[model samples]
Target: MMALFRNLFAAALFVGILAAFEPLNYKDCKSTFKINSVKADGCPQENGKCVFKQSTFKINSVRADGCPQENGKCVFKRGTNPTIKISFIPDRDLPKLKASVRSKISGGSTFTTFSLNNDNACEHGIECPLKAGQTYEYTQSVEIVNTYPVVDDVQVNWVLSDEDDSNKKEICIVFLAKITE
Candidate 1:
């Protein structure tokens, strides 16, 4: 009887650990723009930002069909489209901008390119000639095709560059994701 109780306790502890969702980890690749916050469908929002614990920034599990965390990584289902919203303030005026999305699997040096419906930032949500120091919200839908292999620990990178000078990146963000069936 005592052994049974011990086993039950151990199982419960393991399940609890798995249920604790870690905060989304993101980085500004170019450091040219200030990312105010990022959130998906089910994350809690407050004061125009996603509400997360201060110390660890742990997020809660999302609803079904929404981007949820499993094994401490955000899960994106194949053949489904997930929308991501980002708030940022650019340092310089961006008269024209182009968007690019790419993914790099774990331990892989080469990145696979992905396409958005329209590569123009102005077409998506941003107004033409974005003013500096003004916060702007940009929303995009990522199409996860059925052909993509089920991969773990994939680095998804999104960049907005100047159409005139491709080298000048206005904003660059990289986040971790997992693709599942």
Candidate 2:
């Protein structure tokens, strides 16, 4: 009876501690894009096809980790949901937009894609299909794995594309993140 009572008390204490420290949310993480730079024009090619015109969205900045890091590298803690903030200018409204993140480890790679809209069910409250000629900030949240495949550098590639026709890419951003234990 005494052992049972002690075990119950310990379990209660653990639950209380977990409740006190709320799980990391989207608002907690940061972006990693460069700041204060004029948006550049470029034609991105995917699968050997490139668009003739410049990208509709001009990337202004991407905030990740604590501060703005070069080459899109950011720092993040394990077991936390890291939010990436990207700012850009929409030269034109996109009827359909597709955003994806590709994470590459030593032996394998995985990609997760989402379409911005009300039904996307995004955890960070990101809505898609931006307005034309308007500047907007977008946030992407992802769960940082806590264990396995730990490396000094991880390549994170973010891509935005138009789905109206031919699925032309709008922007491609890459960042290296150091995941701390």
TM-score for candidate 1, please give it. Answer: 0.70
- Per-residue lDDT over 48-76 for candidate 2, one digit per residue giving the tens place of the 0 to 100 score: 21111223356555444332232333545
lDDT of 1 by residue, 10-42 (tens): 999987643432234444344565656555653
RMSD (Å) per prediction: 13.5, 13.5
All candidates' lDDT scores?
0.63, 0.45
TM-scores of all predicted structures: 0.70, 0.53
What is the Å distance of residue 54 in model 2 from its true position? 11
Which number leads on lDDT? 1
**Residue 66 in candidate 2 has what lDDT?**
33
Steric overlap count per candidate: 0, 9
